[model samples]
Target: MKAIKSFSIGLIFFVVSSCGSLNPINPLSLLMGNSWALSSLMGKSLDLSQFADGVPSLNFLEGGKLAGFTGCNNLSGSFALEGSSIRLDPGAVTRKACPGTGEQDFLGALSKVGNLKIGKDKLTFLNGEEELMSFIPKED
Candidate 1:
């Protein structure tokens, strides 16, 4: 009885410790487990640090869904990726209007993204051959 109890506790511990691994592998799995923060937009190098509390990021989930912070409002949408080809459909996003925030510009760039390139520590989204946005992996 004591041995069984100890084994159960060990199993529970293992499960809890491996929770991070529960994320399934998908086409975007290579980009998963990382939050890519917006670094640049429309060829302009944005200084997001000056925004004080505004930090925008994109995270691709296991399914075809995506969740992101639009620098002002929260956003979630469906995405399709094949090889380097990608498309983002911003289906449902929060409509809270925060003046002076570049929410529209951010969403516009995201909608124009037709391809993705994952670098050593960065992620780049492109519209055709032109780079639309560049991102750096957020620290865990």
Candidate 2:
């Protein structure tokens, strides 16, 4: 009887400690060579193409350097992972501004991103708790 109680307590402790492992992987780690689409803009979900020319791309190299497309133009930025939150810095990009509402909208969305989420097989950018963009892993 005492053995059963001890085993139960040990099982509970193991489960609790492992819970943090389920939090999810860093989004930047999953962003490598992945093309991410804007699922929700500002705070709503709409056809991303309704305001953009192409799906944004995310590429991570051997090092920590990061680069991607901003739908309108190409951008390169540095990123760091803290637990599960992926943080992006103000990146340098092509100065030739893209025309049309889509380009403008894409650029605007990038500005509002705070952190990112990486799931088992997808990635997302968050504005507070709301998801702004989500990306699926692409086949190389």
Candidate number with greatest TM-score:
1
Model 1 reaches what TM-score against the true structure? 0.73
What candidate 2 gets wrong by more than 4 Å, as runs, is: 1-28, 33-40, 43-53
In the predicted model 1, the residue pairs found to clash are none
Off by over 4 Å in 1: 1-27, 47-53
73: Cα error in model 1, Å: 0.6
Q: Give the per-residue lDDT of model 2 (tens digit) for 1-140.
A: 99999999999999999997795454445566465554555555555555345665666655666677766677787777666566665378766556556556655666666777676566777778976666666555
Per-candidate TM equals 0.73, 0.63
State the C-alpha lDDT per candidate: 0.81, 0.65
Best by lDDT: 1
Candidate 1 lDDT tens digits, 1-140: 99999999999999999997795544376677688888988888885643333877888887888888877778788788898899988778887766654777788888889998886588899988899999898876
